[model samples]
Target: MTRDHPADFEEIARRFSHLWQALNEGSPGTRKILVDRVRDALDRGEARLRDADCDIVANSFVLEALINDGAATRVYRARHRDLGTFHAIKMPRPDHADDPVLRKLMLREAEIGMGLRHSHIAATQTVLRLSDGRPALVTEWIGSRLAELLQQRPLSLGEITSVMTSVLSGLEAIHAAGFVHCDLSPLNLLADGDLSRLKIADFGIALKRGSRHSQFDLAFAGQPDFASPEQLAGEPLDERSDLYAAGLLLSLLLSRCHEESDGTKTLKALTNHLSQQDVQDRPENARAALHLLGGSPKRPVDA
Candidate 1:
């Protein structure tokens, strides 16, 4: 089937204005007043787009097939009429499209993803408005989550090393861009054929390093089982928070190492890494975890 291409930002803005006008029609006097105020806000949004010199390439393509469903969004495999071929689109539930805070957070996630360019990071293709006026993000289509493969066949130490290295490299690139992926877990990690060839996905909880909004108390982002202690304690965090998560991930790998071996020390590392209440207590970052996996320190802890 031939897909419809996304309109340019200017055209999209014009359509948005027209839609706002239509919504304001036939409203009660006070309701009309509020609608008019909202219309003004839409105008400001258009101006911001103009000032930003929006890219038409950044428009999301509509997917022809549904991929999966999650708590707040649905995934689809879409063909980009403009870009050509397929990409994945994530859209919020139909009922929550008008939620201001949720929408803003989704946009932020898209923006951050788009800015990131890393071999192990899933690239964001576009952030566009759906036919029903809901916001959605288009991203490179990943075949499966890392967790799925790990569940099927446990990863060898050498195999886990490859995955860890790439994961850390991707994260380092993100840190260099001055962003923190507040949400890091197996569910958010995707892989192609093997664990070594993995890509980091899902940025709904990511934040700019120093933005005021970055300081909001997000007790735990994403899966609770993989959440760090500081995340559980509702404390503000930075790169170290990510490190703690990487440590937990390492423990998961260690647990899967031997079918009969219990991962007690690995769990101890995770606990102490957070109990110290210091990011430093956590390995410096993904690279540090990789170093530990390589037997750098030569500790007598159970592997």
Candidate 2:
């Protein structure tokens, strides 16, 4: 005899079913009202299911903000809703999304980034697939970039040692894995919130040492300030080339940032030598640079 909002669709269904049964005892008018209510209840149930499915925005990450827009990729600050933690999601720029080349590069970077699981190296959490079928690389979210910070202030000699050691540590692991970070620069080097640790980012152009590559691979994806002489010359790259970049970074780190530069000609010479136009004259590898920093005489690969 009366109609009202039901507790929920399930409750509505249960009540309507009983109403239908009662329809057999009622007039035709009452039976018609019960039929309409049944249709409404079914519609609500279908809508609820669609809403539940809509909750999953992307397969893995839900974007929270656009943290950076680089030349090739746009990085988003996202969260893994399942884990309730923050991460950085790197996706192809909007215009570049449809480009097959960019897609291949993104997959390549994801492959390499996922392989590295070192402390000083930012860890790639997982690969995410967008609704458009594009792949995105998700890494642990970091809040600071070393390049930006250094421009504002300098580091103490002790602080320089800490940063260099950590960077070298990551480089060692990378080189030992047979991969050379073709683009190692202050811009891509990230430090944790407290500036206590460093994490290397951006491997889109990294190449395996001694691996075959493009003729223009040297200038393809590197920052000029940090690009090694061999890298700039289109010569084959190895761990030593990355060492050259590391040496340049090490030089920048030791600039007036330290409270005192009592006696640092040796460090200066090491950095200068690393950027030499001739690759063979640079430190043999990351280990050699570390050794030089530790007061050992520089015996570059002059041999």
Candidate 3:
């Protein structure tokens, strides 16, 4: 059978197998060698996250296919030589890495991603140092942007429902994890081909509830069309802010589904409820929206 990972997967596996054997075989010398090997592998910082305009090896992954480039960071499609799997690596520009606030934001995003789990949410695989010694985050490659996909074709009501439901499911998961995706927007949501699979992504500006993030002197100016009013006011947010963006996306999709259809009124009302200037008037969280729209929502997790 063909294997996916590089040569080290087997070497790493061998080390682990020996370590397990040492546990039972009462072999301290053998165990020490295996443990040291595993530690060295980890200290090497093999996995990082995406592509811009270059080909290089950060650790175990080879970065290629310059996919996105911005002022602060670059993304590249990357390959894990050991596993033979492809992923995206995101890392800061070398110069920006020296800015304390930007550096903190990058690391904070990684920390938040590492803590959350949901099928509708993109998986953040690992955070490691780049060849240039900057921190990078590696994640499974998302196929397309939702904004880009919508422009390509008109989706049916059923398809829009699937996409919105999936997005809300992801927001619900973010809430259960006690972090607000303070920067939710269509631009940040990703989808695979056919709009059947959607994942809420880009937690870069996310904030933990009750934590003072101004320590880094970072503030999010909400997206004009999709941001909640409270977000514009720079108030500390909770899950409600994310629900607002979810509602906005749902409305935008529905408006395109059938501009003057019979179901438009109800979806419009739901969207308005979500966009209410007073956060109290809106559905407090994704669960509330799921209740309004009728879907199985995840149970909330305690702090």
Q: Report the poorest 10 consecutive residues by lDDT, candidate 3.
A: 294-303
- Tens-place lDDT digits, model 2, residues 233-280: 666789988888887887787674644443356667667877776778
Native-referenced Cα lDDT, model 1 = 0.67
Identify the candidate with maximal lDDT.
2
- In candidate 1, stretches whose alpha carbon ends up further than 4 angstroms from where it belongs are 1-62, 81-84, 210-220, 259-278, 287-303
- Candidate lDDT values, in order: 0.67, 0.74, 0.73
Question: What does candidate 1's lDDT look like per residue over 147-248, in tens digits?
Answer: 787788765545655666667777878777877786777878887775666889888887676333335434346566666566666666566777767767
Worst 10 residues of 1 by lDDT: 51-60
TM-score each candidate: 0.67, 0.75, 0.75
Who is ahead in lDDT, 1 or 3? 3
What TM-score does candidate 3 get on C-alpha atoms?
A: 0.75
